[model samples]
Target: MENVAILVDGAFFIKRALHIFGKLTPDELASKLCSYSEKHLARDRKGERNKLYRIFFYDCPPLQNKVFHPYHQQQIDMAKSERSIWRLQFHDELRKKRKMALRLGRIDDINVTWRINYDKIKKLCSGRLKWHDLKEEDFSMDVKQKGVDMRIGIDITSLALKKQVTQIVLISGDSDFVPAAKFARREGIDFILDPMWAPIKEDLYEHIDGLRSTFPKPCNKKKLESSY
Candidate 1:
């Protein structure tokens, strides 16, 4: 009797699903996730009652202030609205500062180049081009309101330490979780990595007991019907 616990990174899962399936209604996304979990459990021989311990959903809410492109907003809204699962947990304001830093660096380069080129292009046309209002405050980086990684790390570590679950399933592709996976393996738990719709890294697979991509299966029609 193996007890399995699933830890899902909501933001990562939603983004990957959107990229893979195109636009999906909230119900559609939830159905896909439910199907994914069930299939994994079946494959692991733990789909039966009492064998599956619990599924822990971990994710930070979207940056409320940052303007999400319309399509992204739809997906984000749908994920937050899902509240049917008892094990689901919400962690808000989890910011990805490193990714943000990299984006800001690229924006700075674009700004410098635009400053040099914009005036020249305008002069050639004998006209002035007005730059859109830009502000440093718009690019400021701060702590994520949700702190997803911290929450996820804590849950994985605590569960592994307590030996509550014989197997752990992580539904994320972020390399930030390598340490947690390693720790789980050291504690003799079978760590499985399932990047629902994302690419699985070879290095990540090396640290886990197995790797499974959950994007090929059909989504749960029942859940999709409810999302709308």
Candidate 2:
């Protein structure tokens, strides 16, 4: 019997689920996720039950400040509420640090004789860097600085090297995982990519052995409400 390990990107999954199914209560969402997992397991090898391995959910806690968009805030709120309900061990990445870096300048003071550099630095300190002040190329510079991809990759590789499980199921749509998937495949482990309720990427199909989407069905409102 092959053991199947499930690695869930909590942030990605929650956002996808909420986007697909309206706003669901924490318990309702957790139940739906479990159901989705069961379906994925049953779909493999003619309903033969695979050994249930540990389910690892990776995500950073919401910024202590609710600075994210409204939808994102809802997702993060649901995740916090669901942690205890689902017995999910939350693994926090440095999301706040990344956010800070994106908003703040990266380089230390470079001595410049130009008045423009001094003026720019003063404006930055005064919180005057508006959207118009930035150039098109600077859009990329606003990306979150934390490397969630690197963290996920390291864990996947470490588990593969340790021979912790026979198969790995990763729940994320981020293409950044392509290399990690390749590495897992090289180790002769089955790499399944489950994008929870997100549109499937055709290019990713070739890399993964199995694909599953966890879209919530039209659930009864009363039942969902009580589960919370």
Candidate 3:
């Protein structure tokens, strides 16, 4: 049986989950992630499953500091913020899951700043909205994630060199993993990319053994619910 190692880009997964799975609690989100990873283990026609070596999840911890919000005209304590709490709880849930490795990076808080929302900036550029008309929702904290891609690359190289798994499934939409994917394929590992229905770059097609997405489409929420 093929031994599979699933690597997840946590931020990408969370953003896509909001669009595909809708709103779910942190615990529910973590459980759904595990369930999603299990789908990769399914083999052809006969009801067979592959051996799961492990799930490596890469993400940066939420920023934990007080930053002034220009739109809100107040200081926001990110450490006690809703997103921070949710992320911490989600990480904890992942830790309790079996055969899961939570690999965390760090936030570049020193260079952190509030960025104007894309839509708001577009409106301003098109003369549809004025600068003074921007509301609190028009701005969001820009937290730069550092070390995540590096950590992912390191883990993939380690797994391939150590012969820990015969297959590697990366669930991310970014093209940053091309080098790692190429290396894994050269090592005789079946590298697969699961963008979860998101479109990937055309150049990415040549570096992987196969492309497969093992989740319900956004339009098929009912099927996803039934699976659980």
Top candidate, metric TM-score: 3
Off by over 4 Å in 1: 43-50, 65-146, 217-228
Per-residue error for 208 in candidate 1, Å, reads 1.0
Error of 3 at 54 (Å): 0.4
Residue-by-residue lDDT tens digits, candidate 2, 41-116: 5435666678656665565433222123222223233334443343233222212211111111121112211122
Q: Is candidate 1 or candidate 3 better by lDDT?
A: 3
Query: Candidate 3 — which pairs collide?
Result: none
Model 3 stretches astray by more than 4 angstroms = 44-47, 220-228
lDDT tens per residue, model 1, 1-228: 567787777656765665567656555556566666756665434545425666666643333232222322232322334331311221221121111100000111111111224434465466443323323222222223245677778888988999999888888888888888899899999888887645566677688898877567435432221111
lDDT of candidates 1 onward, in order: 0.57, 0.57, 0.88
- TM-score of candidate 1 against the unseen true structure: 0.58
Q: TM-scores, in order shown?
A: 0.58, 0.57, 0.92
Candidate 3 Cα deviation (angstroms), residue 100: 0.5
Which 10 residues in a row give candidate 3 its minimum summed lDDT? Answer: 219-228
